[model samples]
Target: MLILSRLRAYLRAVYCRQSFFPGPLGVFVNPFYLARSALQEAMRDSAETLNGRLLDVGCGTKPYRNLFHVSEYVGLDIDSPPARARGVADVFYAGKAFPFDPASFDAVLCNQVLEHVFNPDEFLAEIERVLKPGGKLLLTVPFAWDEHEQPWDYARYSSFGLKALLEKQGFRILNHRKLRADVSVLFQLANAYLYKLTERWPFSARLLFNATVMALFTLMGLLGARFLPDNPDLYLDHVLLAEKSA
Candidate 1:
């Protein structure tokens, strides 16, 4: 039992490190490899511009912490049993207001979190309040993806809808991108479905089945990209870099 637990931990560490910008092993094992790879690239490109006191909102495991060269890094999450199990928060909040002064942070990262917030307006408002004037907000939200995190998942935003939400909170959009569009999205969805279907199987059987499916789908996605007409409208996620108005 102890050995199995250690193995799970080691595998999780490897997945966290390489699942986003996957190599061969990651590509096969990670069901969401295509979308994650795109998100990671976008984040890495944007991370170059961020510095100083930074806050990571809904920072589950702080997977991208090493990407940024910041003076101070603080992680915040809702106080919940799942969060406690993940050991995800440096400071947990009550979901009303953040435990920080206005304009306390130079940058904020809210990756893959907005969809889970029931009151996005209040959430964004708090983020805007905490950010220093001209401070950056690096956010990523799913546009076309499955409902996850069970009943906590509340919303998915289109590109325009996301832009409006940020602008409504007095944020100026600096960079906006759609990740894993068109054929890649199709492949990703198929892979996700297959992953779900194999969930009840034994660990080794599930891994082998999903890995084979991922590899095949990845190849098909690549080929389709080369031959098919591009469609940016159908995408998996939205990546944005916005700034608080001065």
Candidate 2:
């Protein structure tokens, strides 16, 4: 088991270090790059609207802190016993309501967070309440990703659905982008399924088997992305930029 753990760690290290495979291999397998890199790219692309006092909802590790030039960055999450042990947020709430007064923030960033909220409409309402008039809201949500955070993973959003929701909440949509192409989505989902299949095997064997599977799909995905047109219906995530109505 230790050997397997070491092997998995080594493979992850290699995957993180190597940004992409060479040439055309890079385009298809680009999605295989460390997940953080892709997320960082998304954040950087949308950083312009993230100025002023910012709020990070469900801020785990505040991973995109350096990407924005905000005056103050406050993090918020649900206050629960398990969450407290993780120490992942600056402020934790006991109920559905936010603690702050209305129109307190200039911008809000919510990444990979909407899916976990039991009442997305109400949650978005709170965000709108705390954001000043003309404030910006940046969000990223999964459209095609594996279940995570266990029972907490509650929803997924398509670009159209997200746009409608944001508009309904009195925010004007400025930009919406797909974080990955169809090929990347296929590769990630397949990789997830294969990884689970290997879990029952010896750790070392599972590591090697999953490694080989990942390598093969990485190449296939790269080629597909390079050769095929992106499908609008498929993507790993949707990044959105919206402005609160003045």
Candidate 3:
């Protein structure tokens, strides 16, 4: 067991450190992703409650590796990773059909990856095929945003839509949350837009605008989460934890 573990570790190191990966999410991860994540971590079921072999699909840069305390982790992506993708992935591959045996994983994490698939339904079905019976899937998808990474970009889904789709694939949602709303959404759009304006507006004006918008949104989350009738459904990121039906 120790020898095989070392061998897998060596192979993972060589594979992840290679060139051609999308660098770090810090570069391509979409800036607004942070604010949404803050809300998500605050909202629900984030801690790794399930312990078994795990897989993270389209795990660009692999930011959530630490959240799970699983026995093993595998991160698969279309390209090689920027740095060593943290957490633990035995191997990183180059396609949607993940290379694994049937029911090989206890859980799958597919964050911000589905929209980029050519056929998300088929891709998700593939996710279903790889999970052990009663294993879980943790996924996050976008609902609003311009098409930037097209060719790779596919479609967004509503909460009900995704839930129904997963049920059809033989999974049951344990918990779901849609994060980032109203001012938070506004700040995200403004931040992205104002970044472009840095070239247009003066440096001071741009910085002031960006800071003020961010502050407002941050305050909105604090104040609104109690009194603002905050609705996760009409938000930026939809996160779900679903179990493969028995």
Provide the lowest-lDDT 10-residue window in model 3: 19-28
Question: Candidate 1 lDDT (Cα, whole model)?
Answer: 0.87
| Order by TM-score, highest first | 1, 2, 3
Candidate 3 error regions (>4 Å): 1-34, 39-44, 80-89, 181-183, 199-227
Candidate 1: residue 82 Cα off by (Å): 2.5
Taking all chains together, each candidate's TM-score versus the true structure is: 0.92, 0.82, 0.71
What does candidate 2's lDDT look like per residue over 193-221, in tens digits? 77566658775565466446666776676
RMSD of each: 2.3, 4.2, 10.3
Please provide, for model 3 over 86-168, each residue's C-alpha lDDT reduced to its tens digit, 9 standing for 90 to 100: 53445766666678889998888888877877776778899999999999888888776556566767788888888888988
Clashing pairs in 2: 28-221, 28-222, 29-222
Candidate with the greatest TM-score versus the true structure: 1
**lDDT computed for candidate 3:** 0.66
Q: Could you tell me the lDDT of residue 49 within candidate 1?
A: 81
Model 2: ten consecutive residues of lowest lDDT:
20-29
